[model samples]
Target chain A: MTALASDTRASRQPISFALLAQVILIANSFIMLYPVVVMVLSAFKTTGEIFDHPFALPDFTQVGNFTKVLGETEMPTYFMNSILVTGTSVILILVLGTMAGYAVARYESRTNTFILLFFLAGLMLPLKLAVIPLFILLRDLGLLDSRWSLIVTYTAIGLPSAVFIMAGFLRTLPLELEDAARIDGASEPRIMWSVMLPLARPPMAIAAIQNAVPIWNDFFFPLVFIQTDERKTLPQGLTTFMGEYTTDWGMLFAGLTIAAAPITLLYIVLSRQFIQGMTAGAVK
Target chain B: MLVSHKQAPSLKRQLWVAFLVVPPIAFMSLFVVYPILSAFAYAFYDWQGLARGEFVGLKNFREVLFGATMAPVVWNAFLHNVYALIALMVIQNGGGFVLAWLLYKEPFGFRFHRIAVFVPVVLSTIIVGFLWKLFLNPNFGIVNQALYALGLDSWAKPWLGDSSTALGALILANAWHFIGFPTLVYLAGMQRIPPEIIEAARLDGTNEWQLLKNIVWPLVAPSTTILFTLLFIGAFNWFEIPYVMVGLDGSPFGSTDVLGLVFYRTAFGNQSASIQNFGLGSALATLLFLFIVVFASMLTLWLRRREIQF
Candidate 1:
């Protein structure tokens, strides 16, 4: 009887410890998400109500703030610009990076190895350090204040990691397929395009998401290169909007929600893919 | 027919390879590699905007390092970057490590907790900065209100308004924004550990604390190296949060000034002024780049030496 009692006591200790851990984990997650919850809740409240009962649930669901931000500000335009820049840049990055990654993975040559090393070196080069020269370069090319400038810059900045990821993914693919395609008299381009490209789609998606997020979120380049209000990306536009509407807390919150909503919703929907893509780069 | 086709295809393949590779390489060289090299050259010439002036031969470096006008700003920004590095390492990465350990146990709702913690990471820094700014607002912000409600009103000062707490607040916000990254990475590292080794340690009557300390911690050394190196680089590279939240001047008496902001202001000027000195900006950039490279390499090397292999 004493032995059984001691066994129960020993077992009880780990269970109690696990319960403690669960409480801590839940509390930590709550703290992690509290600010985001506050933002969403405050967005639905009026300025008066927010101040009056900051912690309470909104008295009513209010779409008025969203309407005001979308209708009144240049927010829609900013969103369009962000989409145009990020979409074009991501497409170009995936295409070019995949090609480069294929070359590095399949072509066994000293030159190919050297090129891979060169691209890898770019991973360490903080583009912020080269902003001055890039600014001058863009100005000289007559590309300043143009969305194309951002597209090009983002593509260049994003390529290194994209290439690295694509190459790593491609290396994992069975070479037998490519070899068999070649034996069947398929041209190298055809093999790559039809055989390899389809298999590379998963990694392509990962690279696309990885590259797209930063470009969509980028404010630094737009702040420097873009001058016109219409040309501004969402992040840059949000900052300018905040500066102008510093006093209008309700409207500012609404504007922030507008800027954040699409990505936030996308993250919620495709969170598994997002998390996998993000962690894959580091883990591999 | 097959023999003739083989010769033609081999030549075509080389052309195809060139077509595939050259465009990205040329584009990267023109935009990335060329600019970096020119930045090195631009650091030596006393230039404003685009027109190059006479070669100043490290005069810009001298001004950035020791000149009465810019030295304090430079040093202050560098110090703040260091402070941010230390704070993020302790609070953000340290918190991430703890959370990873707990999650590794497969507690209830672990998946929900993982997803929730990582949600902020996908949001833009602009959104994060503005959201936090509103939350920390003294007059009507939730933080102050919550403090008052909890009867801790004495602790509810202006979080971002005062200089003493401004940087700290920014650090906390920054940590909040990125904690998920390290958490997931550490979790990945922890998952790589073999279950048999852990089960064996448990069979010897080791408690959770002992097993974690003796077995898990050493195995996750690679994650530690990766996280710390990234944190170090990111600390120096920080701009967007401070830029969006506090403005480029690192407001509240420049308490949140960082090297990235200083480089921006020096090169492009701010709302108050329009002094575009390319030489000094490039010099600052060069110094920052060199510091990051040297220290990061050293840290990585040291950490890698300590990493344990299973």
Candidate 2:
């Protein structure tokens, strides 16, 4: 793949053009990253200093903002709620999507094609369009104003893309692997579990990253459904905090940091997977 | 079928397939499909608060489509969405093609640059919106501050507060947040173009521009299709960015309003805005859904058939 990517003829551009191109790419990266860096740095600065020097590096030793956000506020509750809701939804999506995708991939039938299309349809039309009835449905189920409402909605929302990704990847694997497992007398579920699924890690990661990022960061459903502060996710909770602490730049930036840090750290650490996972659809 | 497993292996396989597929599809039916269908149904009824009052038979659609109060707002917001879609296609996707071209050339620190480009895409839209709102603040924002330092004080203004600039600023923010996506996707498409084709083209004396025009562009048609379809869907469904940056009301006289925000405010009723009109809101939602599905599907098929020509 590396050799293919770095084509020999492709590198034959003039040295001056390559230098100019590298400079432009570096500048673009700077433009992309500079503002986020400012947000993170502002979290560690004093409110007065943030106003005075918006671009200056903050004093790293000043742990006051972090402590205040963590201890003196509802940040922890929102954090936990985001984790619970996103974690639960992703788990359900992966499990259900994989099972459903396995069925659609291994079983060749008219029903399977229809099922795949049904799920694929969800990918194009966002669930947010149906929020009005969804809220009513949750109310009827006595799940509104609760994390369960968010969990179910996100699971449903994430499944279509997950199933699409999973099924597409599963179809690319050779049929002989499944035949070998069947000849070994493995049950259908066992063959899927031990053989097919292990090979499915790439798609699972892609689907997980695809779903989890949005689920963790989603504000709309939580904004409408979970009106109670106790059930509020990070994105929505951050807004309420932003309003209350509008003048307190230090705490505001700290709140933003807390909401953003986990995903940012994970992306930086596992960037290969994140990029591959998020952009997997376009490549196909 | 379950009982006849010993007599019929295919029937047994069918049972396994049902077991595997039913639970998830049922879950989706209960949550995603049912609610959406209900939302479409709600568009046909006159609603008194949450309950359906009577079958109004497109009266709500009339009010939403042609009523003096909503018609202008909805179309204006929709026009803004179109503007955003066009602007993003040009600035973000077009810029991305150039960036991908550069990266495809394998520039210095290209690997690090690839990761850097995607960092903003991973951040929440809310965070991106708010961060930009602060950056565009009139008095102390670095954007204005930098302008002043450069002795170009005329360029300084409240980017979000100004009616003329608010929607453009939001589009720019959206582009910033998502530009990495198109860049990488295009890069992936470019990498898939076998090197031998490029070598042959270079031997034919095809200049860089000619190579891009004649060889790479057509080959990357698939990525273009996916990106354009997604951009259309995303543009029409845009909510979070404007909602976060401008407010639920697409403020400064609604310069930044879009269908997603209008749908939310209508269905849920903002305290400062209109009261809840679930019927009318559902009409807008249903229309938006169908509009997206129809155009996106058509675009995909059209681009797909065009791809075969390459």
DockQ for each of the predicted structures, in order?
A: 0.65, 0.53
- Candidate 1 local lDDT, A1-284, one digit each (tens): 99999899889999898899899888888987888877877778888878888888885568788888989889999999999999999999998999899988876644788888889888778887899899999999999999999999999999999999988889888877877887788877888889988988888899888888879998889998999999999999998888888887778878887788899899999998888877765775
Local accuracy by lDDT, each model: 0.88, 0.88
lDDT of 1 by residue, B68-169 (tens): 999999999999999999999999999999999988988889999989889889999989998888888898988888899999989999988899999998
Give, for candidate 1 chain A, the lowest lDDT window spanning 10 residues.
A106-115
Q: Cα lDDT for residue A92, model 2?
A: 97
lDDT of 2 by residue, B165-235 (tens): 99999999999999999999999999988899999998997878898888898899988999988898999
> Each candidate's root-mean-square deviation in Å?
2.3, 4.8
Which docking class does model 1 fall in?
A: medium
TM-score of chain B of 1: 0.95
- Measured with C-alpha atoms, the lDDT of residue A195 in candidate 1 is 94
Model 1: runs farther than 4 Å from truth? A1-10, B1-9
Q: What is the lDDT of residue B21 in candidate 1?
A: 89
How many residue pairs clash in each candidate at the backbone level? Answer: 0, 0
Score residue A144 of candidate 1 by CA lDDT.
92
Residue range A111-136, candidate 2, lDDT tens digits: 88789778877766678889999999
Give the runs in model 2 whose Cα sits over 4 Å from its true position: A1-13, A108-110, A172-185, B1-7, B10-13, B308-310
The TM-score values for the models, in the order shown, are: 0.96, 0.93
